[model samples]
Target: MKVGLIGFGKTGKAVATAILDNNELCLEWVLRKRTLLEHRSVPEFLGIQSDEPGLIYSSLTTSMEELLDKHPVDAIIDFSSDQGIYTYGEIAAKRGITIISAVSHYGEQEREFLKELAKQTVVFWSPNITLGVNYLLIASKFLKKIAPWVDIQIVEEHFREKAGVSGTAIKIAKVLDLEESDINSVRAGGIEGRHEVIFGFPYQTVRLIHESISREAFGNGVIFVAQNLAGKEKGLYNFESLLLPYFYN
Candidate 1:
């Protein structure tokens, strides 16, 4: 399988490395705003080299049409700008390409676009793609089902490097029928990630918490999702949807 990576950031580089690690896949193209002068090859960007000789370096261009036309990948894994992703998704859907994105497109327009696109193609949309976070979503649903009438509150913390709230917390909040503001986001140094959804009543509380000791934990899971995103159904899918068998059953 040939993969196209749309971002050259930490997670994008991680996904490229993971794809190379999988003997069944190859890097077809990579997109970044500026090419790294020293590390032109995807392997070098990911800190690994491909043993396969004559492997092509992707064409670097600013235009999406040029990029898509130059390289035809089996699947396009987007980890780039939120706006860029949705625009590309529309194009990918029309072109009948497999698209998996790791950005949260949560506004009214995004939801409407994704809902319409799902009818014609399969796509996976999630704010975060970590397996543990997906598991947290699954657990939250069960806790809600068994204790539907319980009061719910979500709190989460991430590294200061991460400027936003925990995406997983937001997802859980949506599942529990809580307002988006109900999910609290905290930024702190030395904390890779932390999330807890608490269910409370008059006298007791049930909490589900998932933490990450290092950012690499999420890197590993994100790569796994990128590689496995081929040939899946066309719809707005989430990591929780992928983990349905493990926790839902």
Candidate 2:
């Protein structure tokens, strides 16, 4: 299986490492805003062999057609921002490539692009790919039934350098039908990650916590999704749906 990557940030690099570790998939190309990093052979550095950095390993094209024209990718995994994701989704839909978007849910226009894409190709999108977090999504639903009276509140912590609030926390909140405003964020010093959803009532608080000992935990799951998405159909899919059997079994 051959895959294309969008963005070359921490998450992107992490996913690249995981893909290199996998024998099943080959990274076809990476699309970024800038040129390839110094000393990293666009292809060999990414564990592939190709000459055109833009066409092969990392294409610095604003136009999607140029990237698609060069290499017909089987699937694309994007770790880019929302705007970048919107552009990539449009291209993937037009080119009929399966896309696994790691970015969170896009707005109306982006959804429209995805809807159009669904008519022709398969698109798998998720905000958080960490298997543990997806498991928590399930546990949250079950716990709501089991502990009927407990009130749930979520607290998340991330590295200071990380942007925005916790997308994972927002996702879990949405799964539980809670408002995004209800989720709290703690941006602080060198902590990698932390999430604790507390179910409490008048007398007690039961906490369900998932702390990211390292970003690698989530990165591993993203790679797993990329590998699993190979040769699949075109449609919008979620991580929890992918893990349904594990939770049910």
Model number with the top lDDT: 2
Estimate candidate 2's RMSD in Å: 3.4
**Reference-based TM-score, model 1:** 0.82
- After superposition, the stretches of candidate 1 with alpha carbons farther than 4 Å from their true spots are 35-39, 52-62, 201-205, 223-229, 246-249
The alpha-carbon lDDT assigned to residue 50 of candidate 2 equals: 41
Q: Candidate 2 lDDT, tens digit per residue, 1-249? A: 677778777777777666656666666667777765632544566565443332323444346776677667778888887777666676777777787777765777776776677777877777877778777888887888787766888899988887887878988887777888878898899988888888887777778888877656656886777666656676777776677766668
lDDT of 1 by residue, 118-203 (tens): 77787777787777777778878887898788888899887788766666677778878888888888887777778888888778
Model 2 misplaced regions, further than 4 Å: 36-63, 201-204, 230-232
Residue 125 CA error for candidate 1 (Å)?
0.4
Residue pairs clashing in model 1 are: 121-234, 122-234, 122-235
Report the C-alpha displacement of residue 232, candidate 2, in angstroms.
Answer: 4.1
Judged by lDDT against the true structure, how good is candidate 1?
0.70
Clashing pairs in 2: 54-59, 121-234, 122-234, 122-235, 123-235
